[model samples]
Target: MTIRRILIANRGEIAVRIVRTCQRLGIVTVLAASEADLDSQAARLADQTICIGPPKSSASYLSVDAVVGAALAAKVDAIHPGYGFLSENQRLAQACSAVGIIFIGPTEAQLDAVGDKLKARSHALAAGLPVVPGGEVDSVEDARALAEKTGWPILIKAVSGGGGRGMKLVHEPDQLAATIELAMAEAHASFGDPRVYLERYVASGRHVEVQVLGDGENVIHLGTRDCSIQRRYQKLVEEAPAPNLRDGLRADMHCAAITFAKHLEYRGLGTVELLVDCERDTFYFLEMNARIQVEHPVTEAICGLDLVAEQIAVAEGKPLRLTQDDVHLTGHAIECRINAEDWTQDFRPSPGTVSRAVFPLGEGVRVDTHIQTGARVPPFYDSLLAKLIVHGTDRTQALERLRHALAQCVISGVSTNLPMHVELMQQEEFARGGVNTAYFPWFLENRATALRDQRVAKGN
Candidate 1:
């Protein structure tokens, strides 16, 4: 069954991105926007728009009832919950199935399996994928015991958490019990799940993930992406294919991801995130994102595939059309998330209006954005203003293109992290490629020290 119309239950750049794909596929788009996003770029681009609820996510984007109800009312053949919000939600998938509307993602069971951190780890181990040493901690005593066994500097993570909301790093034994309690409370408040787990922290870990597309029976990987440049576990820069892996490591990672996806008989687009311990020269399964990722453009640039189109086709009950051998990866691509935040002020959200937004356009450059001149930067949603992606013949060429693109980007009215991207491009370690996850924090510290030294020299 072909999907004639799709209800995009999302907003911002991702929503716009989906709309563009649907348009190209000759599928009508119905945007289920909140009151705040009534005039959003997606709303303008879509064939039709329907108000789901108020600006608050609970009443709108996060509301399964609102989303499914809008899909029912719009008479759309499917609902695409673009990444974040309810993209990985099982209830939305179930509700869509109950209503005879397709959910453009993995099955409900798959979501449940991967949504819980512990369950995902179990599945990874079953699929012969190595995982970090850790286990579930149900109580303060349980956490303390696990901490003792896992050694110092362990991570206290919420079982149902992502984006670093309910994660705590405990460096010493004295911080174990209290940190566990705090993490549990924070997890409860954030994800409505109080369950927390423990994991041994790898000090020199790099964030790498494999992009896979499966149609229930067959799975094929697009390649790998290195998202090690992050702040507080939130990725800011991503590149493909992952640079500087030990011999045979990249192929092994791709195979592991495919094996895990096949074990689940996964359908639709997913990302198998892994933590590469640079010191150990090995990788461990982190978790799976059961929806299209924000950094997917880098993969698209290298593979020349529209991931959203593939997702819709899978939802339409289509089998895998492209085999692993059919997929050819070329060149290198890098993406910098341009967010409406003040990097100097602790990355505080700067929501107001985009008075002027000018993005670079030329060979080897692409910008995916919903914001334009005079657009309102609403405070209720993610602060991402655009994604600046560049591709070239190789990593060096990609880095050069990214540097020029960053230099050409201009956005005013709301303070953005453009300056941060510009400086990051010039950093020798980053330019050299294959920096670990801790590299960003180290860069920040060095930057601060340099500023202090400059101030002292200037007699300020």
Candidate 2:
């Protein structure tokens, strides 16, 4: 079952990432893109390129039919949905299966079973994984009733959404009804499913996740990644081998993640997210991502594993080339997401032509991006411009390298969150490590206030 030709069913950095791996593995890559991305770096790097439709994602990237049709037309043997769009969509797997084309991801059943938040929760509990206290809510009234039991500051989570799209936080019991209503509406608009459930909110928890690879029966973890640095519940920065994580707690996390994967007979690469109450040394299952994560490179840099290549190997019915005993985590790696946004103005998307682009260089620094100096960042997709990853012997060295790397980066024409990332690298709390999920919002708020006060002082 050797994979020969691969069609990338997405665009941007992830597409370029997959193409790089496929090329190294001696496989031809067919890149499918909308008209807006036909000239992207990924498109130019691929062995072949297919244009599906216009700039809109629905007409191209997220259109399963269009993607599959392009793959079939290109005569590719397999399709790789890189990270977003149809990466976790079971329908895409089903579409690939119907046409006898390999989907370089999990099986449709495994995808559906784990992708459904409520069902995955029940499955995790059954598999002996520690889960946050909560239950499925059948209605707004039901959610309110659950909130009464779980206490105030509850989380309304969408059953079918990821990347923080269909989630709302209710601070008080009085806000429960409105938050539930809004969450459900946003859920439907984003995921086509309005079902939501309730969960106890961890106000100061750290976001840690385990990366695992499986071949139907056995599963092995690639250690933990800390993704607590986020904005609006969307992760912006990630680091491997979560700092200050006690060995006992990390061992338990690894064991539980593997157990859950094996219980589900999961194949290919997936991530199990957990919320750690850093002060209490306790953690609970948050959710499972049944596809490659945007932050996979952090793990790859530390573990020295090509996860994309491993995904293809597992899809081909091959056992993981490395065992638990052989697996090693060395060094500290950090990744800062560079997005096309004006961070000062509530992060409005600032997509446009990349008049100038000079990514950081030197040893231990890696940049994964589909934009070059002349590339145009399309407005129809996520705002990500590039991922700047750095690895060093220790956390201090890694932090210093990230700062230097960010300093070396240069982009123009479109406003980016570059300044924000630069400021973040200088934060005392972030440098000290073990900061919780709430840190980013607080930092942003404080930074804005400080700037305003400085402006007032100058005017006076």
Question: How high is each candidate's TM-score?
Answer: 0.99, 0.98
Pairs in steric clash, model 1: none
Candidate 1 segments whose C-alpha is farther than 4 A from its true place: none
Question: Please, what are the lDDT tens digits per residue for candidate 2 over residues 1-460?
Answer: 9999999988889999999999999999999989988888888999999999999888788898899999899999899998888899988999999999999998998988888998898899999988888888887788888888888788888999788988898898778878888998999999899999889888879999999999998789999999999998899999998988889999999999999999999899999999997767799988889889999999999999999999999988898788898889999999999999999899999978999999989888999998888889878889999999999999999999999999999999999999999999999999998889999999999988999999999999
Q: After superposition, how far is residue 66 of candidate 2 from its true place, in Å?
A: 1.1
Q: Candidate 1 — what's its lDDT?
A: 0.95
Compute the lDDT of residue 119 as modeled in candidate 2. Answer: 87
Which candidate number would show the highest lDDT if scored against the true structure? 1
